[model samples]
Target: MRLPGPHWPSVAGRARADAGPLLLAALVVAVVTVLAAAIPPLLSATADAAVRDAVRRDGGDLQVHSRMEDDGGPSASRIRHPRLAESVDDFRARATEELGPGLRAAVHPPVATVISPTLKITDGSVLRTFQLAYLSREGGPAVTWITGGPPEPTGSETASVPYGAPPWPVQVGLSEADAAALQLRPGAEIPLADDQGNVKKVQVSGIFRPSDSADPAWRLAPALLKPVAGADGRGSTRFAGLLSRESLPDARLAFGPDELRRTAWFTPDPARLSWDVVPPVAAKVVALKAASGSSGARDGSLKWETRLDGVLRDVSAQVEAAFAQASLLLVTLLTVAALVLLLAADLLVRRRARPLAAARQRGMSLPVIGGELLLESAVTALLAAAVGLTLAAVITPGVALSGAGAPGPGAAGAVAPGAGLIGAGASGVSWEWIAPVVIVAVLAGPAFGTLTAARATRDRRVPANRSARRWMRDTARLRRAAAELGVLLAAIGAAVALHQRGTGGGVLPASAPALCALAGALMLARALPFGTRVALKRLLRSRRPLAVFGAARAAATSTRVLPLATLVTAAALTTYTLTLAAALGSDPSNALTLAPAPTLGAAVEGGPAAGPLAAGLLRLAWVVGVTLPVLGLLGLALGAAASAPERWQTLTRLRTLGLRSRETRWVAAGELLPPAMLAAVGGPLLGVLLAHLTFGSLSLHLLTGAGPAPAPPWWGIGAVAVAFVVAVAVVVPVEAAVRRRRRLSEVLRAGDG
Candidate 1:
């Protein structure tokens, strides 16, 4: 019977020797899992916040109106019918209840009129305004006074006014400019006549000014009720005024039929309102309408208009869509990371093949050997899991970053349901989901290690057959080429499908660049060996000894060019994304880095320079670009280490042949340089081509409005150079380190010529 493998003492020695690579593999798994856990939630939160803010900046969440259509008929001309008033009341109550306390709700009579007041300006020109009246409800705009404070309360307010002294006023507020033009001031009395020629004197209780907030709603509020000379024509200072709900009856007495005919009331325009004040009020408006039931819906002429809800929902959907794209990118990145880790593990396993083979020959069963390796893997996995989970927990809460600059008015005011969106409040990581994440991280390292170790052992057991090996070697190239071609074709097909989907709305597919990058890299890697060999052969014919030797060596090592190619391809993908973003002049990195984490923030900053979806895609692309190359570099390092044993032996032989150490290092450096250089040039070119192919039709106007194609991203070239330099730096040291540890005699005695 075969004996079981020795216990910890025997296994510990081998584990120690291989600890560096094993730990590196674990680290990769840990880091990848941490990033994976953190990214989606963070990106989702950020995108949501950004979209909400953008929508808020435009207006509140929605603009709701219960309106009776005026077909310019005599019936439409009636201003104060009981059915209309009751409908408005019902709509307001229902909207408040249904929309909940989080939303702002207001009731307006759908009344806007061009009122030619009985009062005359100092210049003897009659002043007119486009007048709109809002009922004083639980949530409605206050007629704020910029000067002389608010007017005294009038006993005329009805029960509908819920706050602040019943919201009754016998006076009006005018914009500073309008008041000045009309020679009016605080407490000034102005006479106004109704369509029936009834006249009443209304007091100008205050002179108001606009706030610093650029919210067009509040900024134009003072003037919306008033008239502007520029737009309303230059006969007089067309007055803009603010009036309380209690003043409505008196207003009718002072205004004419022409004014009444021009009036209709509705919720404030979303695009015209401030973000901070719109959402809650809008929700309240919706609730009010729903509560009104058939009262507001009685006639075909009566309609409830709500455009902001759909707009807000669409904006939120954009965020969710961007999250999907970011998730796709994360998946791609993780896949690349997994592939790199597996490659490195395979190399480590292969390096230990001779020891494993000897053990097997000494009566150690495969299962016994496999158990020890499995134990080592388990240990590594546990460590990785702990690190990954810890990191995930710490980082997740901090990732609720805003994709847009800040939460706009929609996120501002009260803690409404709308405030639960991304960037509006702090987001916590769900521990329920974290257990699975930890498990995945734990499994990542061992799964790949065990598979590689099992494969290596099996290969060891197979007896050498030169002809068979020759056939396998020859066919490997063909298989690689076929795989590359297949990938390219599949990427092309996806690109076509993506193109047909149109970029009119929602998030664009992230897979386009990832697939293109993979296909391009693989195709280039597959072709590199043959092309290098052919070119080197041509150089070999020159017959200069050093040149011949270098070219011959390069041609021989061309078989192992995939890792270098992969490194380049990954770098290229990153470059392409950043270049595209830079070309558009919208730096996603700035927004991401500068944005605040989700919190019950004060007031948020301004809108993002880029659209939420656009910024999100760009940010995801940038992150993927930065991270993928790291995986590529790790793969290259493993590839270098895997080839170290053979390289050291070759260098030892050269040293014995009277070549100095410096010359040997140069030869080694040169061996690595060609592939590195080839990848550098090919990688960026492929990336640029793929970018153009996938996003060529995307708005060039994003970069420069209706202008010619903008300049190429020169920064991408710099990135390539940096990546190349880093690759060279990493590769050369690996060679030198391996060289330092080896001696001529050790190599000579180890069965080398």
Candidate 2:
């Protein structure tokens, strides 16, 4: 017979053997990767939606108005007078070019006005001072002619027509409402005198009504459509008369260059506005404003005025704050996910211990074993990451440039036909998120495997040198205590820093909740055995042997820091989510919670209003709602599974002592329930406390429309705590059932072998 060489299992066979643990690892990795890939884009879209909605709702305030007065100063002479040398179209083209694409520029080229203290209309109404300004026919508001038609330019260049005397009066139009209020109708002539006492007569060529009063064009000059009350205490009002474009020259001649003003209003295309572009656009607007104010500016005579930059800055701030809050929550989830991945890796290593020990017995080096595990894990994690990233890309909706059909409140409108979408071309996989998760998943395998193998091979026999052993034991205990104390102190420091600096302080403040949770978990872990020992003593006094046996097992149970921390952190995150939802839900303007706010307040005095920012917070809450529960459940299940082998051994012994399967499960439950219950109860309390400590510092008033932060949602917290308990209770039985299905003989043989 041919000498049989050492046999190794085929890759397919090994994969089949380790399928359960590997599959679990793959699933966890995939889920985490999906979260990493999906969240950034979703959050980005949310921010984009918030920003765009605010911009659109800005309405008239969004206009960039540049006014150039014919001051006839030295700076005015230095500026190129494009209007003087070019046609109206050429001047418009030049202005449009200067403004750039996506901005519609309307040139209200130098218009002369006749400002009079009083005007006498046909009905003998002596109206207060009315200014008759020539309105540019180009880009004018759409209107329905109630009586007559729009004014036509007469082409007359008369400097001053004697009131009601020369070549017909300058043709003008008035809103029907204005005409009705002033007792003026079509064919009515109003005589007005300029500041220089030059007389001009304007005849109402038409009485019209705006087709849509909300039209942005009407916002450019509202006084033309409605009268404005004068500042005088006598209740005098100021009115505007809309003269035909052709009358501009005549008015200019009569009023002189001193009274003429050239204004150009630029309205940005809402479709072009997004969160990413806000800074650059805002910078440009600021620069424009600065240039307009400078004597050396290209168009020094023009003064550009806009609240757009201030509005954009406010929007940027709100978005950053919202992002900071969201980032904290997301970081919490990632921390929990990392802990769960570690738990899963530990489970995988435990499941592979027998095979790995056999390999070591066959003379495999620790490095070789670790390398194999690392390769296997890296391959599995990479594959999972690819699938997860693809799935995330497929599921996430593309970011639309068009504001139409946005999910935000008051955002729905007709979609522009050619609007661009940000899709696969802009893959939202934030590498910052992906790198950490992928590194953890890949490294967890080999790290846990190597350390576990090293521990397994360590000599466990007691040393004959009692004094040295005692010293070593004390040294180890002291080191652990020092480590725990250091962590605790660090946690406290972080919390204080977070309270002082708030979320804007970056990573440290964001990590505070996790640090606090870890500190609490560590303390609880240390206290658990002592607490269990007390329970054990109480149980030993009881008549029931199952209770006494369960208590003993629980007292001897090893503390797992990661699982406890994961559970506590998940609970806290869930509580925060519920609390935030409750606060936003309580707002009377439900629009802020349900979607983008129906209106965005001007960033005039106080700041941008809280509605859009609140809506962004609600979106983050929804994200937390989906993610935290899954992470918590996964952690709970993994924790339960971690103890299954030991629980099974106890169950076997209990059964040998004539206990029923149901009784064995009860014993197992008793062993697990105390810690689970502790986490369930303590986690929410910690969350509530954290909220109290951080909410005020979080600038939450921005989300609550400057209101005080709402009280914690006690009912919801209780419900979450109860649900956690129920989930843990359910998990214990499920784990027991699964363990029971494994034949007792095999379990015993495996344990012995």
Best by TM-score: 2
Residue 188 error for model 2, in Å?
A: 6.9
Best by lDDT: 2
Candidate 1 overall Cα lDDT vs. reference?
0.53
Tens digits of per-residue lDDT, candidate 2, 1-753, equal 854332335234555787876787688778877766665566566556666666666623322223333424242222223233123334444444554432332222222222323332323344465666543424555678889887765543323333223433457788866787777888877666644555666778888887778865555566678886762226666566675555544444334344444445566555666666565566656666775544334442445566767666666666656656666766766777777788888777776777777776676677777777777778888998888777776656552222122221111111111111211112246556556667888899789877777766767776789897998899988998899899899878878867877665566676777678778777777777788888888888889888887787777663566677677777776776677667665667644245543222112222234455566567656666567767777787777777777777867866767988888877877777776777778777777777766777665655565544647778767776777778867986777667756776777777621
What are the lDDT figures for the candidates, one per model? 0.53, 0.62
lDDT by residue for model 1 (1-753), tens: 956654677478777888888788788767776665565555545544554555546533232333332213243332332233344455555444444544433322233322333333333345453333333333334444667654444433222322222112346677666677667778777655434544445677787654432433343233544455644456634454565444444343334323332222344332333333444554555545454435334342222445555445444434433443444455456546655665655665666666666666665666666677667766776688557757766766554222222342235333222212222222443232233334443454445444544554564543388887887877986887778788788777656655764232122243556677777777667676787688777876785555555555666677774466566656666556556555444444345433433421211346442354454455555666677767767776776677666665676777888877777666666666666776677777776776567555444343233322423476765666567757766677656765676667877898431
Work out the TM-score per prediction: 0.69, 0.79
